[model samples]
Target: MILDLNQFVSKERPYWDELTAVLKKQEEQPDWKMSLPEARRFHYLYQRASSDLVKLKTFAGEVEVAQFLENLVARSYSRLHEKRGSTIPFRPVHWFLRVFPSTFRRHWIAFMISLFSFLIGGLFGAGVMKFAPQHKTSFIGSFSHLSGKPSDRVAKEEKKQFDGFERRNTFSAQLMANNIRVTILAMVVGVFFGIFTVFLLFYNGIILGVVVFDYIADGQGVFLTGWLLPHGSVEIPAIILGGQAGLIIAHAMFGWGTNLRLAQRFRRIRSDLLTIVGGAALMLVWAGLVESFLSQYHGPTVYPIKIAFGVLQLIALICFLLFAGRTRQPDSIHAG
Candidate 1:
């Protein structure tokens, strides 16, 4: 049956106002969770209100129409209402541009702000490198030496990350899946794990910082760059971006409200979060290709190795500019 508007509007105005506020929030900004009852409530409320507003506009006294419109508008905002659905039928260009400045801004901005943590993570990673191996060595000495040795047959079979080969030595599927896995880890862990993402990033940074120190200390810093830069340039940044997304959810939790309403807020943020997560996935794809092909090709030298790294990194950068930059060619844009 068609729902009766009078049954809805005849209710006391103040109570309606409160419910309206919650509903508006759902419309404006959905929550970031699996469930979104608050948003659903707003959807139903707005649909009803829109109907009532039209009815009052048509037949009700002028005073009543104004009141009805006022109530409809009020419900939209009291819950921090934002646009949940497309106002018009379609806005492809608008959506394409949407994730750039709005939803994903926090990912980049958070990184800039968290630069201090990066330095700290590096320091700790270095510390772990210096201290942890020493403690484990006595018991692990034989295994450690064995551990360092490449089990070529097993290594190739598993594409064990420890064998220190990337794309050049490994197969494409291994490269792609592993690279994507790390990128996905960054986003998924952050979203599900919340502030724990800080630890994840920090831990990785620390491990990396220490590794760099070890390589430079051994006068193999150049070699290290050759090994890492090709895939890592893409992989590391993607992971950090994922962590930033997690932070957004954590921040949302800081606000006060009912569980239903919070779910609504998350629902609103999902589209934007996907942009960051998707970017992470893309980076992983690039990393896999670089690791599987170039990284496996040359061993330990800048010319054959690092040279390849520099060239590929540059190509990736150029690709990014052409695709995302304003001056991209029409044909390329279409191709992209």
Candidate 2:
């Protein structure tokens, strides 16, 4: 029911003022704790203010009263319900499942550029090693000696990585450290206007290609597939994402579309980079574990298992990036 604007204000203003004072006290004195009776009174006042707001809207030309009620009710609701600062719960699982994938989807173009650069570079390198074997040393120096030799060198190098430590644990840790180092390097070099990031992607791709060709030349294709794909599937994508993060920063600084102020753009870019880089690091840790423990074990018995595992992992990763955090688009129908 409608009342005179003056009468409505006269009746409701006291409750509004009381609720406002209670909320304000909490704001002003951090150490001031509300007593149980006071909290119950505050909640009752909040309910009264909400009901008053609905009534005030019924009075035509009571704009000022409605606005005051709106503010009072909001502050009271916040005081009673919202958690602030350190009170908020931290859930890593929620962040990974929801926040990370959404961030990945937002900056997917950078990932594509990184992925294509590495893949094309690798394919080109492989073609060169196959057709122009004479120049294999020019591209891949250390691996050059392995060409046409037995696969013993590859096995020996694996052994060397785990020489001084327990096989699974320390080797996994070392592998993680090394992979993280490379990913960080890729990210750091993106500051060179992304020129260095591009170089890194191509370099990594080329090395992979050369190594694969070398293994093939020695008639160890299956062995290389089991060892490489298991970890490479995850590790390579993570490294590319790190590069993607850096390139995003480079783009914010120098590339096209400077509609935002420089500081504002950089702030937005920084937030996106944090999520991308963090997710990439997590992937690298998984890759390192697989590389050290699973990929290195390449006998006939475990060969098919490793290859299948790699395929499944790669598929799951792709699906996660593509579909996770995606909401169905609303229908475009509109009422006439």
Candidate 3:
């Protein structure tokens, strides 16, 4: 086949130069990490340059260009296959503050799907409660305590006080254990193509919707908000994050866009799953502490404070997820 060597060299030189610039930058900052898009582009450039070198070798005249392309491909290959180790030590604070949030943003679509499933369940539960009150018991399930009137329950809780710090601590431990178990289950069930994970999320949302609607319908909206928001603000999101991890796992199982093997797909997403679940666990721990220490408290005097705290916490979390880990400077390259 006749080859337009001059046209090809002209067209490919820009890509080769771009690869050179990226390589130079990496050499200057050995700890720098490429974002996903940058990594993909770099890979494409490597492959293209390698192809160009092969084509050039077929012709005997372009020796200098061929050598340059060979070196470019070699450097890119080395960088791509380098040992998966970081020169910088792992820092827990950095991981939580930056890595966790960044990971969450990376899979925001899955998170939205998780949230949507929960909302659908909530709507269903609320509809049942509003239209058919007798079946409340069926929907309430384990939360039989809420079967009674919201006002009566609120009154009882308002007058109730903890007997001692020991009781509070015990309650907190129980809450933590229960919530963490639920969150873990939500993530682990992703192995089943996320069907169970979606159901779990939806079921939890049904309980929430039923409880919230019942309280509001009975004129206990303020009480309900104060009781739930303090801990639910973080606890709810944590559970949703667990759902997100599950869906991510499910996507890997399906392997919709890639031809990678099942093992390879799982390997690619394993770190992301762990990162999301770990973040959720941490959030649940905080939620448990808040629920036991603050959320369980009742009365008009403290309700506003608890509500405010919860709102602020939720806002801070939103900001962290949206903006954390974003910087002009490069980060350390780490596996997903």
Candidate 4:
């Protein structure tokens, strides 16, 4: 076979340069994390450069070009292999501020599906309550307290004084435990192809919708907002995150877009699953504390302040999920 070395070198030089630039950036930012597309591109460039090195070695006249290719291949090889070989120590701040949110963004579509399912359930429940008020007991039967009029509950709650610190702490702990259990169940049930996950989310949303509609219809909307928004804002989103994680697991189970084996798919998503669930758990803890200490309180004097606080917290959370851990530019590979 005849070889055109000059043409081959010209064709591949751009790739070589691009790979060099990527390697340089990686060297500069040891802790930088690449998106999946960027990672794939990096791997492709590495393999291509390695192949170029082999072909160059076959024709011995271009010693300089061959050495350059060899060095580029070696650097990429070391960078790639060292990461797999090494253990990166966990940094809580970094994980919370970057890893968790970035992962949430990565699978935003799943989160949207989870959210949409919940909203649909909420609408259905609200419709039932609005038109068929007699069936309210079917949904609120589990909570004997909510069976009464919302105005009555609000009046009774406002008349009561704040419970002591010890009682509130105990209540907070109990709330945290219950919420965490529910959230974990939402995630673990993804093993059943996420069917149960969607059901759990929908069911919870139904209960919420029923309660909200009941209160609003009775003209207790202010009380409901003051009572729930403080903690419910964070708590509801946390549960949705659980649903998100569940859907992710379901996707892996289905092996939607790849030919990877079942075990391989699960392995790839394991870290992301852990990060999401862990973040949701933390949010639940905060929600529980707020529910016990602040949300349980009710009065005209405190309602406005509580509503403001809840709104601000919710805005902060949305911003964090949308923008946190976002880099100035993606680490993309292009011809240099």
Candidate 5:
């Protein structure tokens, strides 16, 4: 299995035969498999090799598949030194990571995993939050309550601010940051038996799932979701992502894969999680602002304004994400 192979044979001959063989077999795998480790391996290899493959597949001057044979030869030689711990003059992984998001999209499992966690956790969290006593005390550890403020203070203030929202809406950099924050909170809450993340999700979920309930509870659901929708849509995803990041850490700590390498995996993953957390923080402020000022201030007459702004933010988000793949590598290296 090329998955079992590390790199190429040597600089003179990368592992083309093995890689090609594996790619051929990999092409037959279910679409979801494209996200798995084996599929990832192929993606990595093929992406590097694609330029040559394209030549053979298309723009050849009536050249045969043998024209693509160079990659095989180059890869074979590259694998030689790679396996032996010698320099194969191979391209660095960072080079390809620049395209990782688009490249990794073929691996739909990651998204499915993320969304599945969001749905299950969000609903579960919502149910527990909606029905559970809001004033109950924990049996262990320390409680971090609001200082000199009622539990409802933050929410009420948030509502007040929403009723008076305004901002120089840029590229929804605020929303991106919001995505990062919600995702982080979701993850950080995992530190408490993951119940916290669940509750957090549940809190938001019920708040989201039953807007009518919120309106009924205080005649504020419409305003809440609306103000929230301006940024909640962005902020919530970030928090969910944060929660997912937390779960990843928890799993690594618990030796999800194996005991021998659990710590090693944690070490490997810590930075990635932190980046996710930081990104989450950035998203929250933006989303929070939308909730605080713009969304709330826009009355029924402001519905059109909200729609127009929301669409703009949505478009801006897609554009930023499109560029994120390119940015990820540079950011990661700087992070490292």
Candidate 6:
């Protein structure tokens, strides 16, 4: 049952006010330290405010009350989670384990859109190659190296790139640079209303689909899979996450039919964008390393090993996003 706004606010206002005061004090005087009793009081007040916010969300026609609680709770949450010079420090690990996964969980819908966008583009490119072979060159121009079936020369070139430590290091650096450049471009371009971000993702997906389609159509599907999956398993997801981040930034600006003020929307996006971009960049680095070191070692004996490792990497990525930070402090603000 929904309580009357008057009654609910009358009951919860004290706690909310107390939390707001504590957060305000922290913001106004960053160097000020909270005593043991004050810290306990702040925690109690924050928990009460969080509980009231949940109740407010469940009831309709309480927009003003809900908005107040939302802002208050978010501010209080940020204050409590802020780094302190205590023995139990909590900034570095907090971002990866708490903020990143929470952001991922919150924006899953955007991620799905990103995934589908890429898949649709890839399928369209594949169709162009398969149905209208004349336009294949247009779609697969620079990536022609990956097309028209496999050859010994191509295999030897791949091996040569990874044959030595110096070459492998150089290749890894190049891979990271290229992937990070694409990821950053995808994310930053969203500021232009996200149109270019969409085009960039589609272009990347088209290239991938065209190459894969060519290999499969030429009866080199298995070899191509072995060569691609090791690094691509992580690389593709990283790119999709970058797109998700960009879409989020764009959505904040375009309103998406929300009633939030510009400041509110910007705050939400700012909180999430850092964690999303940071996580994606980390994944790209890992993908680059794997691509340079492990992806080029293809053979009857090595192929299954690489594929198995790739599967494990994908599983680990999924598990981290779904499960990490689940056991965080109860009062931590829910990301979104």
lDDT of 5 by residue, 146-190 (tens): 221332533554454342224445434554454555576677666
The Cα error of candidate 1 at residue 199, in Å, is 1.4
**Worst window of 10 by summed lDDT in candidate 4:** 79-88
Clashing pairs in 6: none
The whole-model lDDT of each prediction reads 0.57, 0.81, 0.90, 0.90, 0.52, 0.82
Instruction: Kindly indicate the candidate among 3 and 5 with the higher TM-score.
Output: 3
lDDT of 3 by residue, 1-336 (tens): 645777987898899999999999999999898999998999998888888888788854576777888899999999988776545776889999889999999999999999999999999889988998788888786876788999999999889766455588888989999999999999999889999999999999988988999999999989999999999999999999999999999898888999999999998998888899999999999999999989888999999999999899999989989999876778879999
Root-mean-square deviation of each candidate, in angstroms? Answer: 12.6, 10.3, 13.3, 12.7, 18.6, 12.9
Model 2 backbone overlap count? 0
Worst 10-residue lDDT window for candidate 5 reads: 1-10
lDDT of candidate 6 over 1-336, digit per residue (tens): 767889878887888877877888888999989899998998888888888888778865588888898898898888888765654654877888887998898989878877888998899888877888677778767765654445553455556534465588889989998898898888888888788888888988888887778777777666677788889999999999999988887888798889999789978788688789888899899999999888877666677888788888889989999888776567767799
lDDT of 4 at 255: 92
The 10-residue segment with the lowest total lDDT in model 3: 82-91
Name the 10 consecutive residues with the lowest summed lDDT in model 1.
145-154
Best by TM-score: 4
lDDT of 2 by residue, 117-212 (tens): 888889988988889878777776765545545478656654553333356888889888887888877777777778888888888898888788
* Structural similarity to truth (TM-score) of each candidate: 0.53, 0.68, 0.72, 0.73, 0.44, 0.68
Q: Which should have the higher TM-score, number 4 or number 5?
A: 4
Which whole-number lDDT from 0 to 100 does residue 34 have in model 2? Answer: 78
Residues 212-240, candidate 4, lDDT per residue (tens digit)?
99999999988888889999989999999
List candidate 1 segments past 4 Å from native. 1-103, 113-119, 130-170, 191-193, 256-260, 299-308, 311-336
lDDT of 6 at 34: 89
**Measured by TM-score, how close is model 2 to the native structure?**
0.68
